[model samples]
Every structure is written in C-alpha cells, then in structure tokens.
Target: MERDVVCLVDGNKHLYDRGAYLWTLRPSIVNRIRRDYPKARNQDFICFEHLLPYQVEMIQSMMRSDEKQIDKLNRKLTRTMEDQEYRVTDVNETLKETQTFGQKIADRVAEIAGSWGFIIFYIIVLVGWIVINGLHVFGITFDPYPFILLNLFLSCIAALQAPVIMMSQNRAAYRDRMSSENDYHINLKTEEELRILHAKMDHLMQHQFDHNLEIQAMIFEILSEIRITQKK
Candidate 1:
C-alpha cells in the first residue's frame, strides 16, 4: 500500500494529493504561490493549506496596482477639468471678454440691423421719403424720380453692414468652436471615470470569488480533520 505524500511550504507540512489538491488549482495561482515561496521547487511533493496569507497578499497587490492606475487616470482627468474650468470657454462670455473696440461696434451694429424694430423703422423712413419726393409738396426734390442718390446710399450701407455682420459671425463661430472642444473634454473624462469604475468592480468581484473558493477549501479541510478524529 502506498503512503500518502506530504508537501512543505513556509516550514509547514500538509497532505499532498495530486488528483484532489494539485490539479484543482489554476496554473497562474500555483505560479504566484511558487514565486512567493522560492524554496518550494518540488511542488509534486509539496502541499499548500487553504487561505494562505501569501495568496491573499498576491491578490491585494494586484488590486493595489489596479487602484494606482485608476488614480493616475483620475489625476490626469482632474487636471484637464480644472484647466477647462479656469479658462473662459463660454461663447457669450468669451466674445464679451475678448471684445475689441471695433468688434464691439460691429456686434452692436449687427444686433440692431437684425432686429424687427430696425426693419420696421427703416421701411417707414423709405416710404416717407418716397411719398414726400413723389408728391413734391415742398417743391424741392432731393432724390428725384430715379432716386440715384438713394440707390448709392443703400448700396454703401449694404457693403458696410455686410462686412460688419460677417466679422461678428466669425467671432461667434470661433467662440462656438472653443465651447465644443471643452464639452468633448468633459465627456471624455466622464467616460474614463465610468471605465475605471467598471474595472474596479471586476477586480473586486474576481477577488471575492477567489476568497470564497479558499473559504470552501478550508471548510473541507476542517471536515476531513473531524472525520479522521471520529474514526480514531
């Protein structure tokens, strides 16, 4: 009859069953334990107890590494968020902050020209001018039948107002672009935070599963010891 084999780790000896103990463990788990206990080279003759401190430490080390990586990402994202907040990225605020004398004048002019009040008032002035000139009530016609001077005045106003509106529009477009970029950065940070949360959760769940398995193994060991004692 073959006697049961025994294994040594950390100066403690335990039963070694190839079929029940050795084969049941994962290769990575075995490798990590072997790495920690360098003297345990002959694993076939060596056995490890359930819930080893070294195995727990290995899991904690892995969790620490994951936490460190998440912290690094958090720091980077925080800096980016701070930078974005510090700068004036708001479209209206940026336009107001960077407004030059000429830009302010252009924006004001565009605002007035774009209003319904300005349109209605200009229409009234045009009609009054045409009526006054057509009736010749004052017996003096400043802009005659063809209204050549009126045409020139309107053309000049159009040329000047077009450039001003275009300048204001350009500034608005630049402000909008800056706001869009800031929004993208905010969204990216949010996504990174969510990813970190998911990774941490996965790590914790895996650690818990391993711990539960170790606890079950320890229970089995206690049950085996009780059975042997009862027989003796």
Candidate 2:
C-alpha cells in the first residue's frame, strides 16, 4: 500500500494522489504559502482544499494587475487624443491671419502679374508705346526712335516688380515650410498613437490567453468535483 502524505497547512494526512508537493505548485501559489508558513520547504505537501484559496488569490491578483495596466493605457490614449484636438489647425487660415498689409499687396501683385490677362495687356501697352514713338503718331514726337523715356520707365518698373515678386515668392516658401512642419508633427503623433494602440492590443491578447488557461483550469476542477460528488 502507498503511504498517505501529510498536508503542510492543516497537518492532516491525505492520499498522495489528492495533494501536490510545494515545488510542483505555481511560483505565486508557493510564495503565498511561504508567507504564512515561513519555514515551508519544497518537499512539503498541500492538499487541494488548502491550496484552493491561494490559487483564487493568485488569479485575483493577476486580474487586478491586468486592469491597472489597461487603465493606464486608456488614460494615455485619451491624453494623446486631447492633445491632437488642440494642435491641429488650418495652415492657410493661420498664415492669412498673420499676414501684413504689404504682404497682401505683394501676393495680389504676383497673382495679377502671373495671369494671361496681364501678359496680353502688357503686350498691347508695349506695342502702343513703340508705334506712337516710332511713327510720331498725331505729331507726338516727344519720345523719338529708341524711346529713351520709355526705356527709363521700363527699367524702373522692372526694378520694382522684381523685388515685389521676390517678396511674394519668399512668403510662399514660408507657407510651404509651415505646412510641411505641421504635417510632420501630425504624422509623428499618429505614429505614437498607433504604437500605443498596438502595445495595448498585445497586452490584452497576452492577458486574455492567460485568463483563458486559468478559466479552463477552474472548469476542470469544477468538473472533477461534480464527478466525485456523483460517485459519492
């Protein structure tokens, strides 16, 4: 006949098949046992009746830890979403709001100067000037051939138009830079949010798997009890 094992907690004899050695228990369960029985050793035995409370405590502790972790992730995600709401803005509207009067004029001048209407109007003016001066139209001989006054006027307009066009172009470049920076910041935040979400998903999946195993173990224990009661 096999010898009965003595339980460490209750000091009662139990069949070897109905108890587990301390070393065979989960680390968390063993640690809980050691808290009460400071001198507990690996060779000590524990019956399922005494071991059930420690197993329940271990499962509860794991569930609480999972809840805390999930809550932390939720808080972090909420803060990220709140920050995004305030950080995003329309770049065009912001630029327009800050634009100086001179900058508006420059932009307007550049817009008109770049149009086909301006080109056609400019050609008509040039042809009129050349015809009037070269042909001495209506006895207006103030500007003779190679129109010196017209040349001077053209030079002055070129100097002024070039600087105005340059100013408009510089502002356009600044707007583009601001837009690109905004896009970069948005992309970075999106990436951070995605990473956090991914981490949360992985954590939930891992904990879910662990919980499923624990639940399966509890179901089997329940089934075993039901079978024993039926046999009795």
Candidate 3:
C-alpha cells in the first residue's frame, strides 16, 4: 500500500497521516505565515507544528469567522458554563421552617426576658410580695422581716432564667452563622454572573474587531479597484 505524502513550507517531507497541515490556498493563512516567517513567504503549504509566531493567532482569527466550527473558543466557553448546575436557595426561609418547638420557645423566652416590660413586671411582683408580708394582709406571714422565703424564690428564678437566656443566645449565634453562610452563597453567585458577563463582553469585542477588519479589507479592495479604473 502507498502512504500519503506532503511537503511543508520549510521544504521538509513527511507522510500526510503523521502530520497535520494547512494549504497555502487559504490567503489569510498564507499571508499570516509570510508575515511571521520570511523563509515561508511563497510556500504552498504550512505544517501545523512548525507554525511561526502569530500563525496560530491567525488561524484562531479565521476560526472565529465561522460560528459552526466545533473547536471555536467562545462556543466551548459558553457550553462549559451552560453545563454547570447551580441551585438558588433561601437559607433564611429554610432555617425558619426547620426551627424546632424548643427553638421557638427559647427565642420567645429570650425576647421577653430581655425586655423592659418583663423588668417592670418582675419589680412589681417583688414589691407586692414584700408589702403583703409586711402588712400581714392575710393575717398570716409567709416571709417575715428578713424575707428569707422571698430570697429563696429569687435565687430559684435566677438559676432557671440564666440557662433559658443562654439557650436563646446560642440560637442567635447559630442564626448569625447561617446568615453569614447565605451571604457567601449570594456573593459567589454574583461573582459567577459577573464572570459570565465578562466572557460575553470579551466575545462581543472580539467579534466587533473581526468585523471591523473585514470592513477595512473590503474598503481597501474597493479603493484599489477604483484606482485601477482611473489609471485605465
């Protein structure tokens, strides 16, 4: 069997199957190689591996002209981004719905305990206890002058209230941590959206640049034709 054969711009020979090549028939590729490699100025073929500086950039520019090309950079970038999955979540709503009965009670207890209304009510109860005992209103005294029984009750109230308040505080800390995490998620999503927007902007700028170059080329061709007509 005979193998395919090819010649490079550098006057080198190789089996066609072993090397990738572009034809000089493409004026853009030929011009790009000529601009970069003076030795390949009039060559009829260019080897992929031996492409000189700016040659790859030229090929990329040509590839961008055709959107249907599978290896197009913009298509690959957008496709990869589209394939990624992200879920938008509301952490606050989720946390609220997942709260346990104990959590609700703890929060309510903490709110009431930390308020001025509860403070005033507590003071009134203490004052009433002392006045009733001092006046002997019921013709009996449960807590005498020193009010030792009242003191015990006060101690018991403090012992029980402290832990309840702490439980509420712990829940608040947990809420703060969750809020922070939610903020992080929001920031991350915003960053990703900005990146996608930036990518789109870059693609648009590249497309506009290519369009302008094509228009310039067309204008040059038109001017050359006009000059030739005028000379005749």
> Could you tell me the lDDT of residue 49 within candidate 3?
44
Question: Candidates' TM-scores?
Answer: 0.60, 0.83, 0.61
- Regions of model 2 farther than 4 Å from truth: 1-4, 15-18, 83-88, 136-142, 222-231
Worst 10 residues of 1 by lDDT: 14-23
lDDT of each: 0.65, 0.85, 0.65
Q: Of the candidates shown, which would achieve the greatest lDDT relative to the real structure?
A: 2
lDDT of 3: 0.65
Instruction: Give residue 98's lDDT in candidate 2 (0 to 100).
Output: 98
- Write model 1 residue lDDT over 139-230, tens digit each, in one string: 87999887788789889999999999999899788877888877876777777657766765665577645655665665576566446435
- Give residue 61's error in model 1 in angstroms: 6.7
Give the candidates in order of lDDT, highest first.
2, 1, 3
